[model samples]
Target chain A: MVDDNTLLERRNVVKKIVDHRGNAKIITGLGSPTYDVFDAGDSHSNFYLWGGMGGTAMIGLGLAMSIPDTPIIVITGDGEQLMGLGSLASIGVQKPNNLAIVVLDNGHFGETGMQKSHTSYGINLCKIAEASKFEFFFDVVSNNDLENLIEILPPVKGPIFANIRIKSQNPPRKLPILDGVELKNRFRKNLGVEPL
Target chain B: MKVDDIQNNWEEKLFSLLLDHKIDFLPYVPDAGHAKLIALAEKNKLLKPVVLTSEEEGVAFASGSWLGNKKSVLLMQSSGVGNCINMLSILSKCNFPFVTLITMRGEFGEFNSWQIPMGQATKKTLEAMGIIVHRATHPSDVCPLVDAALYGAFSSDQQIALLLSQRLIGKKKW
Candidate 1:
């Protein structure tokens, strides 16, 4: 197992990926506290991967397919990732080159509580990625490997997976920038809103 | 094929038809009867597949996509048809243009008692919601009918259903 110091690093990996992929968008998940990152970050990314609840990857897959040639990176949690594991197979079969999924597997459902997840089963997530036919996959537990991995991640074919084993850490939480209704309105204005 | 050339058992064909029409946004809850279509749809780059945890979520996602100015479709099983009634009513009351491709179960030689109720009430329920339900029984009926549904969904600004019968799917592996 890697040392503990590197396991909990989040900002450096995010910064490296943001720096490397100039135009790539960071689509955050529901369970993750990413709005703060997006609000504070230097880069301007329009987040649209929210599927009301447990369909993060599905939204990523949809956006990836809808706009070809634009790379999409999903920063999702273990519990959130498990919500749509079927999408791994679905996205894999489609083999969208512009898609990259990074699962922050902290071994718990961190949002609601640090509850034990199926990851407690010691599931080989990289193997799951392989089963989904992702050409390149990495299960990283060290922060030192983060920057180097980001430099080499893109320009790969099909979907790429990174099961970055993170530690459960709850920093001071940020209130949701937009309430569900306001979020809907902001998303409409930002992404072009249409009727049902 | 012309939009009128659509028929049942045309799951894959309908998929290609959807691509041809440039209808990209898709939110689907897996349906046994529409398995082939869903499977084929997963491979299409033009159509984005959004798999929902439940049928209602699919509707909501599709609704969001619609608000985003993207044409969206919801693929669900007959059981999901029941789950979507409230949301579907919202779509109708708002005159929303959304296409629902429903896989019919509980009818024909359906051995699973679980599928019976949904299969029996699917069409009536859809009609009760003011949705125009089209039953596609032949393989050839799927594409054209779907085109019509898509057209109706957009032109009429209404919700439409393409109810795929069990005969279209044949037998279930499980």
Candidate 2:
């Protein structure tokens, strides 16, 4: 079985994303501990976004549509993607030029439990994207591919899906600064809504 | 225009209304009853038609799109109201506008048993969640009610519905 905690691979991709500091907004559906890494590092002017399993891609698409020419990166889980694969077709239809949808295929819902996921079916996510006319897509299962993604991803202009196979490692149940409610409130405040 | 004229040709009118309201993003799940409206949306150049797999995702997408500063509308069937409950809570808690153009099912000669429970409860459920529920019983009433629903939901920043009854579909399958 492939290791789920491919830390080096995760680090490399995160670095490439953060190093740019352009219009890239990191969107994730993983729970607090996993998504906090992106929230803490993102330096964009506005951090209006959403979180939760099975909804990141759709959220990213919404953001990308609102701000044309702004690059948005969606970090999704294998289990999450399985729950919302229909997003692929919907996003493909929109065909936002500055969207990159990356899936961390750890073969399980790591936040809740390391339960076996539908990705175990060897479902070709690349093929699924291709079927939807999403051309710039790949599966990065190694350190080399992760590095290469940085160089290769920028020039490609369209909706791209990169599935990175990860080895599962237990993340802490709690985040350092924000709980789910706080995370949601921060996003709402960024959107100019007062506290509820 | 006569009511039949509007009912027989609601697609073009619907598209015009959405554009007039400056609604840029739309999330929907395909329903035969909503076929013409969906097709019109697909053909419209100014409006973006996004097809979601389920109604709940459509709600979440519409809410997110609103947060992103784009006006959005969710189009789905009446039974989909059930699927949207949790997301509605999120919208209500956040005090964000979420508008849905629900094609009414399992009411007024609804054949499907599966659609009954939710159909019976749709308005009550929306009311319970503090969402304004507006029904368009005839095609002639659709445009004004839809516009009103959008305004009510967006201006108040609350969840609301424009329930389009099956009669508007004009398909007598029963």
Candidate 3:
């Protein structure tokens, strides 16, 4: 196992991704992934999930399909992605060109007290994405792979999938509006959709 | 009309309701009861048919589709409802408009003993989670109830599940 200090810091990973997001909307998985996104930068385009544990990627797929002109990125955790592994296969069949999913895999369930997760025990999520028919799949273990991900995020041919390795260290939580309705309405409002 | 003709007629009318209202996104897990409608949706250019790996994914997909300002419906069997319990929390919490067409199993003369528990528990389970549950016991009741569900869901932001009872769907002969 790699040392926690030696692995890439999760905060910087998020900062780089959000810094280059351009006009893309983001959907974060529940828990630490939400914190990571908010820590990077907050925007009305960010749809943060407070409790939906496993639906992050499919939501990106849905958004990409409906709003074809806009790019969609799903930033989620290894635990959340593992819960929705079947979604990769589902998204693969559609292959929506506007959607990209980046799982910030720290190899531990960060939100659940740093328990060693399946990814920690030799499970390869990028392989699952590739096998599931994601045309652009990346295993970001180094800075070059990370740069490559940012380069292709715009004008991308998805379904694109990437698994980025992060250190198993907890950062102070930074929460956005935890109210689901407000977060949802704010997100839709920014997209020029009427509040429900 | 024969029994088969009446059943087909009801299915067609419900399918037409979705088309007429421009419900462009349909996410579904294939079921015997929804087979014909799924087939029709697959062929229609106006509808984007998304095949989900599980029923819960449909809940998330529907929310995202709505966020993008599109009408989305989920189609699943009574058994699949069990998979959606937790994911459906996003709908009620966010007040996201949601409509799902659920075909009942383990009802009437059902032979599959395994499906009985979830089928019987489906309505109460959904209702417990703040979802309005409506059941269509006869072929004639299906379209009207579904139309009402679609209206309440989108216009009023109500989360509703339309249960097409096994009695309406008829017994599956093995």
* Residue-level error in angstroms, candidate 3, position B34: 0.5
Q: Write down the lDDT of every candidate, Cα atoms only.
A: 0.66, 0.69, 0.89
In candidate 1, stretches whose alpha carbon ends up further than 4 angstroms from where it belongs are: A1-6, A39-44, A48-51, A153-158, A179-196, B1-20, B24-76, B79-98, B108-111, B117-174
Judged by lDDT, which candidate is best?
3
* lDDT per residue as tens, model 1, B1-174: 111222434566677778877787677877655566667767767776766656765654465344444678888878888877765644653344779888777886777788798789999998998888898776777778999888877665768888877776564544
Candidate 3 similarity to native, TM-score: 0.97
Clashing pairs in 3: none
Per-residue alpha-carbon lDDT of candidate 1 for residues A62-173, written as tens digits (9 for 90 to 100) = 5566555667677777787786676677667667787788887777777777888887668767789898898778787775656546866553465888888776675554
Candidate number with greatest TM-score: 3
DockQ of each: 0.18, 0.42, 0.84
Residue A71 displacement (Å), model 1: 0.7
In candidate 2 chain A, what residue range of length 10 has the lowest lDDT sum?
A43-52
TM-score of chain A of each: 0.81, 0.77, 0.97
Model 2 chain B weakest lDDT span, ten residues long: B1-10
Q: What is the TM-score of each candidate against the true structure?
A: 0.68, 0.82, 0.97
Tens-digit lDDT track of model 3 for A68-94: 999999999999999999999999999
Please state how well chain A of candidate 2 matches the true chain A, as a TM-score.
0.77
